[model samples]
Target chain A: MDLNTVKERAGPREFSPADDLPREYREAATRMIEFHANSEIMGAYLERPFIRQAPSIDRKLAFSAKVQDEIGHGQLLYRAAESLGVKTREEMLDDLANGDGKFLNCFHYPLKSWVEIPMISFFVDGAAMRRQATLRRTSWEPYAHAMDKVCFEEGFHVKHGEDILKELMTGSRAEQQRTQEAFEEWWPRIIQFFGPTDDKSTHHDFAASVGLKQQSNDELRDAFLDQYIPKARKHGLEIPDEPRIRERDDGTYAVEEGDLDWDEFFTIAKNDYEPGLGQINGRKQAQEAVQWVRETIEDDATTAGGHAPQAAD
Target chain B: MAALENPADLDEREREALETLLKRLADDEFVLAERYTEWQVRAPSLESDLALANNAQDELGHARLWYDVLEDLGFEEQELVYERDPADFRHATLVELPFEEGDWADAVLRSYLYDAAEELRLEALEDSSYPKIADRVGKIQSEEAYHLEHAQNWVERLADGEEGHQRLQDALDRLFPHALTLFEPVDPDVETDIVDLGLRDATLEELGEEWLSIVVPYLESLELELPVSSQVDDDTFEITEEMLPEKRGRDGSHTDAWADLHDELTHTYRDLGRSETTKIMEKPE
Candidate 1:
């Protein structure tokens, strides 16, 4: 279909692999979905260590399950992106390994301890969920379909994270203090999770115009602040003074953009942040190490008339 | 040979035997799950990663069920896991060994060996004198069937190619002896009581022989050699002193890796000075 007609027809679940989408629409949707896919993987990578380091067996099980869910989300999203025909899953994954793929800025920083876990799991995930809930109406049908499952499973992750936060905050003075400190450190990054304001988001206009983006950055950020700020305070965490978030007369919230480090956010967006490079390279090394297995499987598939080996009944 | 219907009915001797058997079952599942989780995001493909993670969670759930049975003896999660001494764990040495990076072969081969033994062990416990143990066996065995299939599928595919075959061979050589520790006695008297009391119908010797009978032929079919083939005589697998690792976990001895792993997993609990463990799921019935 022509670009003008595509724009006119763009709506929730409007586009599918079968659609005769214009190149511009396809490329834009691929970029947006690929970034989402990469973030899921990187987020899983960040939380992988905690599956081992969890304080209790139940917590370990929950963390492992949560991380597993994130990887599953990545798998779904890559397929959605691949359906756009702009790039294959391997190409996107290779791009991620090579540091050309972009993902959420919040994941770029290192998560050092259990105290910091809730900051990512609860607060950052809370923010992502606010945005994701809106994307259930995205123009890309497969992307929206993936979000349906992701949003279903993500509720447990956020609640589990909040459970951790509640436990830490209610514990001894040392535990409470460490948790508060972790909050202060991560609070700004959590605010930047929605990215720069709508004005500064380069692709926002085109994405929104095509109906691929369901909500603007500022709108999503406001929604997140409205919901999570009270939840954080309820858990006894003091919101950091910086990146001043102001409550509007209408009971909504907004972060002062000037207070956030957009320069650093942009650096991370470019995959140039130092700690994030470690995360990317570590995953790359793991991917490279297992290259032989994939090759072996691929060769086996060819020998067996292109059918992948599956679990025995 | 009749089932012991209630935990309250056990005498001190029976209690000790039941506890020993429970600890071995729980510890092996817990430790193997711990090791399996190391492959969470590092598996060769997304599909493989999800499959391995499912197996890990299944093993952990089995561990929780066994530990819950131990709770009837008045033990708590903190006392049983977090604050427990590393050497006190009764898992086999094979479950404690760390995987080398990117060794998908080790992951697959280890699962194959462990799950093969697990199937035989679960079958032996299917008619346990302890009613709780017998009841949980069917649920655990169903999950284990998938684990065994997953491992066998990968092992078969990997063993089909030159590079994959070489990698599988290396893993088999390193892991086969440790796997034998699965049937090692935690204590000779306690093991004897475990069988005499009918906590398990088969003795450890019988389980070990059955395990070897299953895995030995399977490995040979894939053109892989067992490191200690000469030890298998007349269908009875004899584990000589030289074939055993110095650290037999069942005997309260462990490799240095166990201590490090234990310390890391319990770090958050200790750092926060937690007296209670958080529970997210309802206690297994």
Candidate 2:
């Protein structure tokens, strides 16, 4: 109930909506979960086009299913965040549309070609899954529960993504060349996915102190690089030269923070970057277009003497 | 008529009729699923978005089943889909038309119209002469019942309000004619053989009349007007030449939109010079 007691009691799946949580803990948890939820939507938006552009029917079906899963993840997460009682799902989604919401930095860039798909689907999702696996023990019960399902579904996505990457890399020389180029362009943004180092992360201490965050920015980044770097090499993708990665004596990895663009990262974090703004407004316009449909259903429900039935999870 | 138990026993004429019927079924589901995926993150609410996406995947899975049946005729995925000519596709125009941004009315109304026809069509095929077609009908129909309910539920709700009613009316006017193309003949001789062989128990004309009998009354009950009321005679519906679109997809003719869509979907195959389409799921037994 009190902030000191809340801090002391924070542990894996320790808190739920039933708990009379302190405001600080709720707000922090809401922020973390909302960001995670927004990322799911934005990531889905990025992959939506490829559902149509996928070369084969099998690829198209997989892409559509994968994007659908991401939207489902967003649904689960927003419910988790709303259970915190800080902000409702509508408010969070509206915030995302209005450019006040933050998501992962990798989604801020434009995905132009089919070749660029695995860069986001495989490498970036692989990084996100690395962090998500640890969040299974998050202090918030609903958030961890959502992670339970998300982590299960995410393995398919990562595997499917790797399958696509393998197809491209083993194809003709031109296909392989284009895929490598896509990797080079997306590598820096993918590295920035973990955000700044432990020292530079502002909310890490408080979030970790509350058990909402299981790993620090530095720890997650190092773990991701150690695992995915070799996977990239195994796929014949050449890692970019800049953002120089250092191989530690323990066979771990670190990036030179100066080599990355924090200005651009912060700009996207604030939802002001141009291409990212396009992504945000595109979704906003779609939401506005279908406003009447929601109102119509709501009105019908009221006239029928009850609330509209919520969609089954 | 008895059902045909094995593909190996079919003569050339029966084989041609069966292939034509399967192409229509498979292409309609595949293309409609492609269009439905456009609504993934764009639906009005998060829950609705998920529902529509589920429907999309269901349609795609159904398409896979039909396409698998065609593979028994010695066709490969690449020859059937990726490298197939755009004009060779047999899907109806209703499924090919692109949705205007935020047009939830079109999405709902179109689904209502298509799913109603789907129900009748599936029932006609319940005793299909081809055992493969007959066996798969029950599985597909079970999933389709939910699609019909979801569409009907939305259409009734949308028609209840003035703005929603107006939107639904507009979508109905634009999409109704295209929906009729669903029953158009791919080949007159082949269609005749399809019925003569009992591949489907009813003819397209019979199915179209039954579909109109059902949808016409339902639309009128919601205070929605039918664009083709002039074509209705008593309880039976007949489609005239004017009621048809310029592009009858069953005849290997299509709108400009189909060309663009086909090219976009096949872009990856072309760019990568793929000789075969990837198979994610195993061949259906």
Candidate 3:
């Protein structure tokens, strides 16, 4: 509602809006917002293990701040989606923890390395920012307003992440190896971050009708590839697949469709619901870790004359 | 740079109060700051998240300064901060409770209650025999005033609007008991010792009572109930230094929350072995 969504999409290219969008759009928007919310929440679990293991005061401080930001963002976006009447935050989590729900392609995958913190901030947050910035002009008032805030913060995270990567790349030879290992670990998933490119995927129409997502998968992936390739290479970080990454003397790169890895993308997306140990096991583990705190909140709430809802829904 | 180099200039009573007060200040600020950091990535939105994180950082900075003063008084910072058993901690029960991860209102309530008590305590310290600390407290008070104002803004905004006020009222009811406990007695004998020497302006219990009078009126105006409390048997207050394990937390008693918190908190630092020095901050540029 704030920015021009129709103009941007048309300028980039045209795609058919699902016919009779009023109903379908709302359904898909609910699902998409839930997925993004889950991504933000689960993103914490992936990165959290490292904060305790961080090697320095600065690392601890930075990671603490970073994970906190991730969780915080999830809260914000969930509330935004709730404002749109798509889903309640509690319901979204119930769907995530219990019912079938999908997050972004990036989160269901694993994360390793301190370097990945910034890389996620750089590459992933950068990609995330693209989607978010566009959402800043989203047709839905609440989602658009929320994105404005999300985008501003992501800018800082990206810069901080870039600086970390920049230092590692330009640091000593040992730093180079560390940087490379970090790059290699996250690169495949990063490639999948644009999400699988499908014109008529099952969830597509549902998304557009409700104002959940504007850009097609391929469109966003192309935008990401176009922006990130040079920055990745500037630090001598390899793209790993030359054919997949189009290079130009003019200094930009394009994603070759054939080279794009959809199997990995789908594998990750499917796992967004299932995780790797399976959703059942992952759900059990997450529940156990939080059970005591949950119980405490419930018990205290009752005694205090107010209580938070405990039902999965 | 011990440039504030003069002897901390407290009489025995004030000097003793400094030891108890600063640790209470440090631990209270430190732990709440730690808990608040969990909200960093998961806050309802990035701007709000960033704002809360900045507040967390400010608490940590305040903790570090308080600790610096402790170290200046010849105590080792690490031992003073980490090694003490829970029972030895002087912090109130308010700072120790576990947080519900995504509950922004809970976080806001924590801030509002803590900020109110913090302002009260710092105001009392402003005229203490410890000049250096007084000066430092004065500067911190201003920044903390902003934090309190921020908390008040949210409280009034949330509490004034429809069902919003109920949610805030609920949080206040839950956390207010601990907040009241925050003002309970610290040292029993210090009042006579410090007042006689002009080191402290009032006795610990007296100050607690004074603290109540100042805050209760404002809280009443908001249509909120103040936690019932008196000095030692302070009605709403039950926590004391003797409850903690005698260490880093006030009198050191802590829940399992502290361990989970410390693990997440120290994660990055644990890897950077003590032998290596890592840069803590980037140049301002």
Q: What are the per-residue Cα lDDT tens digits for candidate 2 across B248-276?
A: 89999998999998898888788778788
The DockQ of each candidate is 0.71, 0.71, 0.17
User: Candidate 3 on A1-313: residue-level lDDT in tens?
Assistant: 2124432442211222222224334445556666777777777656665544554434556766777767667777787666555567767776666635667666765565565666676888888988887666555555566677777877877887787677667756766776687777777678677665556366655455444567777777777778887789886898775236666676666666666566666665565334543533554444544444344444545765774532210
**Model 2 misplaced regions, further than 4 Å:** A304-313, B1-9, B228-233
TM-score of 2: 0.97
lDDT of each: 0.91, 0.91, 0.61
Answer with 1 or 3, whichever has the higher TM-score.
1
Candidate 2 residue B131 Cα shift, in angstroms, is 1.4
Q: Worst 10-residue stretch by lDDT in candidate 2 chain B?
A: B227-236
TM-score of chain A of each: 0.98, 0.98, 0.79
Q: Write the per-residue lDDT of candidate 2 for residues A1-313, one digit (tens) a residue.
A: 9988888998999999899998999999999999999999999999999998898778888999899899999999999999999999889999999999999999989999999999998999999999999999999999999999999999999999999999999988999999999998999999999998888898999999989999999889998999999999999999889889999999988988999999999998888899999999999999999888777767766777866456321
Encode model 1's per-residue lDDT on A1-313: one tens digit a residue: 9888888998999989888989999999999999999999999999999998898889999999999999999999999999999999999999999999999998889989999999988998888889899999999999999999999999989999899999899989999999999999999999899888988899999999999999999988888898888998899988988988888999989989999888898889888999999999999999999999889888877887987544321
Q: Which is better, 1 or 2, measured by TM-score? A: 1
Name the weakest run of 10 consecutive residues (lDDT summed) in model 1 chain B.
Answer: B227-236
Query: How do the predictions measure up, each by TM-score?
Result: 0.98, 0.97, 0.64
